[model samples]
Target: MNEFPRMSVRDTFARDWYLFRLDLLLAGMPNKKVAEIRKDLRIELAQAAQDGEFRQALAGLGPVNVLASNYLEAHGRKVPRVWAGLVAFAVLLYGWLLGVISLIEGLYSAADQIRPDATVEVVRNWLFVQARVVAGPEGVDSIGFSLSGWGLLGWLAVLVIVPLICASVWRAWLPRPTADQAQRA
Candidate 1:
């Protein structure tokens, strides 16, 4: 019989603990059960180390340990898919809200220009004056004033609604882990 060389106590224990965690995750064990398994595995590995049989035990367990690790890795990829969907939803919703605000502002501007009391030049001058008043000279040449009633409303709506949406979605998607799960991790 070909015998494998002995692994050190620390190395054997570390490998066994890592494999045990992977096995628990792959087995879809409940959080409490996983914690229990981990405790038991630690005790067993410690005893095996004292008995000088740690490497022998690990060699026997190696194939199943590798399989469990692979399985857990495969399942882990699904978490990123959920996160990606959340980010895409947030970006699209923000863009849609901004588009609505822009459309309303454009309509209001057009109506202001068409009023009986206003000429095109008068409306243009009024806009320039308002922009300068809000932004001062420095911003006049940049993006102009963004502190209009519509702009304020848009900013307030985004600030209020985005956090509420995110909080609600997070609660629905990810409930708090149980104490046992937290302990295991």
Candidate 2:
């Protein structure tokens, strides 16, 4: 019974700390920034535990939600809202574009699996039947279709550039400071 209670308390302490860490993350601070805050907390907790004041330390940290809000209030404003929003939008758009590409590739794979012997004529005819082009306001007077190497290259360039641009923006908005800078601070 004594051992069971001790184990329970230990588990609760760990669980609480994990919840605190996640709450910090939920405050919209970047992962690296949250980790830095959590690291300091863990150090404090360890010191308290060494002094047999673990429970006191936990109480001192206060409610996880409140602590997170305070943390965001203090540190989250380093990045401007417009820049952060733009970075988030770019990331989401990049993800959506990747999903669209994946879906198209999956469909093409399935089609290939279904008809391995399909010729260019079959694929072209299928495209002609499915794809519709409208030239005027409502409908096109005529439909013409062409697939070229340059078109494929253009798509590939977009696929590569979109993610690169998003990554650059994300980094700019939430830069992971170097170890030297962190330590100096």
Candidate 3:
């Protein structure tokens, strides 16, 4: 009375690989939707295996990313893309760093106006920007500035950069441009 469904090593491997890639592509999707997808995929894999067209079935489904995107779009979900977000974050952070370096340099140049005897010196590299404003003859009343305030960058990441990248890359809030619209631009 021991009856279990059987699958060959090749079928098992193919099924596992397909599911694994699908899982990765569908990460951050809602759990209910994921479960539904898993169930559907399992049934589809079994049918494909029974028909001896498992590989063709997988191929017909197309790339996992595209399949996942279709599934998500079918469900009306707008998921943020990790690669797009990362690229946006990197570019924004670099810009912020440049701005910080420039501000530090400006402050250093204007140090003399803050105090008659103030002297400015760069104490750290541009990437991890830092400077000191010595306002007294013997290093007294010294002021320091650095890339210490990450809140601006953090806010940009959360509020502006990531969202813009997601929207633009995925066309989340915009309809796909028609061929005529593209030609006009």
Provide the clashing-pair count of each candidate structure. Answer: 0, 0, 0
lDDT of 3 by residue, 117-158 (tens): 544453544444555555444333455665456744554446
Overall lDDT per candidate, in order of appearance: 0.50, 0.53, 0.64
Error of 1 at 4 (Å): 24
User: Residue pairs in steric clash, candidate 2?
Assistant: none
Decreasing TM-score order of the candidates: 3, 2, 1
Better of 1 and 2 by TM-score: 2
Per-model TM values vs. the true structure: 0.29, 0.35, 0.46
- Of 1 and 3, the candidate ahead on TM-score is 3
* Global Cα lDDT for candidate 2: 0.53
Q: Write one digit per residue (lDDT tens) for candidate 2, span 11-31.
A: 456746666665544544556
Model 1 over residues 1-185: C-alpha lDDT tens digits?
Answer: 42344557687667766765565444433456556656666566556666777767556556655645553344331122233345656785667656655544554455444554322222222211233111222222122223467656765576566665764565467545567644544
Q: State the RMSD for candidate 3.
A: 9.4
Best by lDDT: 3
- Pick by TM-score: which candidate is best? 3
